[model samples]
Target: MIPSFLVPLMGGSDVSPSLLTFKSLCYFKCSMFFSPLGMVPVSALVGFGLFDRGFPVVGHCVEIEIPMLILFIVLSQYLKNFKTRQLPILERFALLISATVIWAYAHLLTASGAYKHRPELTQHSCRADKANLISSAPWIKIRYPLEWGAPTFDAGHAFGMMAVVLVSLIESTGAYKAAPRLASATPPPAHVLSRGVGWQGIGILLSGLFGTLTGSTVSVENVGLLGSTRVGSRRVIQISAGFMIFFSMLGKFGALFASIPFPIFAAAYCVLFGLVASQGLSFLQFTNMNSSRNFFVIGIALVLS
Candidate 1:
């Protein structure tokens, strides 16, 4: 299952979904603690796809999303073939480039008043100027531990989160296994896997202390990005973590990204998530599909899922 590792915000709301993937991560920081107490209902509504106002807005976004999806595919394929040692940046950051171009295109439409007379939902979602989030957001804000209030624990919530943690463990296993294969590295040994899971658990515990609703998990979309860009550098992830830490405190910076139209993000997910699913299926080639036992195992796994 593709875990919505973070809450899906409508002011809402993915690898080749990676174009805006990083942006969304940062956006999460803006409201990281805003609705901590409201998480259960919000998560339930999102899981059920029952957003009262967001559904119509999301529908309006498809017009923008479809074109963005096409652009991602075209740019990714074109960059793959146009590789060169001196100009490798294009291929390494192809997803970002596609996202920027399409984002600008969407912004242009908003600036040109193309969405001016559209329905309110379309205007709210499709028009970049409508949100005015940047002006309203503080320039900088420091997030302190337990800033929302002292963390509370309940048996019901604890049990529900335990269920999510179990699923996250399974998802993390797939991501950890897949990442090395994509990067052309050996699979992780059991000890390394155990260490990774330990760190992830620590991260989750820290998120609770720091007032965020969710903990970190292996990002399947990022694994797909590694396969798509073919740039597997640990230093890159380290540098990004540094940036995430620094920019997360910049309230205006996070809010600016939070204002990005949801449809644009949806488009990116179409490409990145597809790559993730394709990569998962690619593993089947390594298995003995012809064997009855293998088929039975696959069938049972599918049914259970």
Candidate 2:
């Protein structure tokens, strides 16, 4: 039985092992063995049993979508060098605009019954699985309305969460350093780093209050996008965050946006994660591989991981 406290961390780690470290893995393994999170996966598996089977075509689309989009972006940028023809504007924002246009077109096609005969196409083209839930749910209800009396504190469980939080902190520190470099900005000031860590703790508290059961951390994916797009403006990040919060409050809008096809999301993730992994490897420039200590550490980490 998976411990409940460790479940979320395990879930996140499963999504991307590239972001974790040897120490984190050791901690996770120890936590898993101790079983601090408590049979969370059993409940989750039961919940998943209620959903329809996922489509293989959607999985295939996800696998190739990002690379294809990256290739398209690169080709479009390269073709811009042709002096004879005036090409349409193509930049980071332009790419997003084009994606929005395509998403809208897909929805239109779905609505117009273009895929009426292809049920799989319709299923894979967009998502709206949560729309019904959101529409039927009460807006102002507290997510966890009842308290199970006084909280029973378990030292082992608390330690597991603490270990995960420490791991998250280490990862966030690396992200903070990497994000600025990717954005072509100076490394964050000491106070800024402190504040960032502090805010992450606050976010964790808020998540618990909101019943998310997950801790917050910097996204390597977005940092990688900063590197790929060459856009480092903090205002852009703030605005995007604002939009997320705004949309999250609008259930229908959020559900609609969530309905974006897997292929589209996967394409973006592929490019972003690839860039992130590459950027992480680029950090090796500062390390002397010729040194046996450094070589063994790096070698063993890679092999073990």
Candidate 3:
């Protein structure tokens, strides 16, 4: 629901090309900016019992996640050659296919009672079917403005949220820069960025009014997807946004996706997030690596982040 409203809103930017040239310093600074954001999924993988108390753990979600990771990579590689006319459907949608296959496998395991005697956390994270969410969700529910309650503000919370918004802006900037490069387009001009930020602010306003948990920002991970699949059509994104909105109204539909095993998502993230990190580093080619100043700046930024 949040993404459905947010994506199109953010996409509605009025960008005008500029006659000015881009600066190398700007490229250098933006290059490694997304490195930290890219590694967030790796941290999530670790939290999913990949390691326990600093020691490696096995057979928790390791069994499922390892296979899922490998499968996604294999499918993506194999599908790269299989195309229909001009569109590489297999390659472009490899992520979806891999996820669907693995999810079905997990569902089979659940039906076989594989997790019946496991710990509560294991069952909760690995199970394909979540009866509670499905049962609790209505068949059709439309979100209304202030549906949760009337808006309230606090000085302390407002300050903290403002900090988060600042971070979100920085992340979105990196995403904006990366998207053009991934799509084989020229870097966005200053005016384009301003327009994007303006639209993002409007999306955030709508998110608050719609009772979303967080405001909208350009998704860093999806930028990686653009790099991976080589699909950069704005119409595709708008269609996806429409699906999100449709699913939001169908309560059970949303709950169905929520029930996908957590480890499966983690495995997918492993591939996607790694690509994001690499994409950030790829920008280094545009900078003067021979310069000591550049190295020092990169080191400091990475370390601090």
What is the C-alpha local distance difference test score of candidate 2? 0.52
Candidate 2 residue 209 Cα shift, in angstroms, is 2.2
Q: Candidate 3, which ten residues in sequence have the lowest lDDT sum?
A: 12-21
Error of 2 at 53 (Å): 19
Give lDDT tens digits, candidate 1, residues 1-305.
Answer: 11232322111011111212222333333333322122222222222222223233346776676777777777777655665666666667777887788788888888888987888977777877646788888888888765666444444555566566666655655566667766778766655665676677666655665667566677666776887788889999999999988888898888877877777766665555555555555566666667897667556654454
lDDT for model 1 comes to 0.60
- The per-residue C-alpha lDDT of model 3 at residue 113 equals 95
Cα shift from native, residue 29, model 2 (Å): 27
The ten-residue window of minimal lDDT in model 2 covers: 35-44
lDDT ranking from best candidate downward: 3, 1, 2
| Structure candidate 1, residue pairs in collision | 9-12, 14-17, 14-18, 15-18, 17-268
lDDT of each: 0.60, 0.52, 0.64
lDDT of 3 by residue, 1-305 (tens): 32244322322111010100121124334434444334233222222222232112124577567778788888677657787897777778888888898899998999999999999978887888887888898999998876766555444544565566665555656677767777888877656765676677666666766757666767655776877788889999999999999999999999989988878877776666666666667767666778897777666656555
TM-score of each: 0.76, 0.63, 0.79
Q: What overall lDDT, based on C-alpha atoms, would model 3 receive against the true structure?
A: 0.64
The candidate, 2 or 3, that scores higher on lDDT is 3
